[model samples]
Target: MAKKKKTPNDKNVMAQNKKARHDYAILDTYEAGMVLTGTEIKSIRARRITLQDGFAQIRNGEAWLMNVHIDEYAEGNRFNHDPLRNRKLLLHKKEIKKLQDAVSDKGITLIPLRIYLKNGVAKVLIGVAKGKHEYDKRETLKRRDQQRQIDRVMKRY
Candidate 1:
C-alpha cells in the first residue's frame, strides 16, 4: 500500500491587508489577541472583515487596533456591534512598550498585516513597518517581476 502525502493544515484567515507589503517595509511582526463582541466574532468567522486600512496604536501604555472593519452580522439585528469601533489588542506589557517605542520613531508605524483564527481564537498579525519612498516601491516591484520571470523559466523545465 502506498502512503498518502501529508498536507499542511489550512489557516482560517479572516482578512488581509494586500497593500501592506507594497506600501511599507515590514521590520517586525507580532501576534495579538482581539477583544471582540459575540456578534463581531460571528461576523469575522463569516469573513466579513477588512484590514486594508487597519493600524495599531499604543496609547496610555496599552495597544489598540483602529480602522479594522467588521461588518454587522446579518441576523444580529440590534445586537450587532459597531462596524468601525476601535478594538483593544491584547498584548503583554513588554510587547506594548516595544510597540510604543517603535511607533514613537518617525516613519515607523504599526500596521495590521492579517487576521486569522488560531485554535478557534481570533488573532491579529501586526507588523512594525517603515514607510517606503517612491523609489523603494519601484525597486520592490522590479525585483518581484524579475523573480516571476525566473520562476516561469524554471517551470518550463
Candidate 2:
C-alpha cells in the first residue's frame, strides 16, 4: 500500500502590514499576545482582518495596539466588538520598560508588522522601527531596481 502524503498544518494567518517594512528600519521585534473578544477572535480565525493602518503605542507603561481592524463575524449579533478599538497587548513589564527606554532614545517607533494565530490564540508581531529618511528610501529603491535588473540580465545569459 502506498503511504499518503501528509499535509502541513499551519496556524491561521489573519493579516500583515507589508508597507511597514518598506517604510521603516526595523530594529527589534517582539511577539505579543492579543486581548480579543469572542467575536474578534472568530473574525481573525476566519481571516477577516486588516493591518494596513495598524500601529502600536506605549501608554501608562503598557502597550496598546491601535487601528487593527477585525471585521465582525458573519454570524455575529449585537455582541460584536468595535472593529477599530485599541487592544491591549500582553507583554512583560520588563519588556515594556525596555521598549519605553528605546523610544525615548529618539527616532524609534512601535509598528505592528503582522497578526497571526498561534496555537489557536491571536498574536501580533510588533517591531521597534525608525522612519527611514528620504535618502535611505531612495537608496532602497535604487538597490531594488538594480537587483531586478541583475536578475533580468542573468535570466537572459
Clashes of each: 0, 0
Identify the runs in model 1 with alpha carbons over 4 angstroms from their true place: 1-11
lDDT scores of the candidates, listed in order: 0.91, 0.87
Error of 2 at 116 (Å): 0.9
Model 2 CA lDDT for position 70? 83
The most accurate candidate by TM-score is: 1
TM-score result, candidate 2: 0.85
Per-residue lDDT for 1-157 in model 2, tens only?
A: 9999532234555777889988999999888998889999988888899988888889998999998888988999988889999999999999999888888878888988888777777888899999998899999999999999999999998
Q: Report the lDDT tens digits of candidate 1 across residue range 29-129.
A: 99999999999999999999999888999988889999999999999988779999999999999999999999989999999988889888998989999
Error of 2 at 34 (Å): 0.5
Whole-model lDDT, model 2: 0.87
Each model's TM-score? 0.91, 0.85
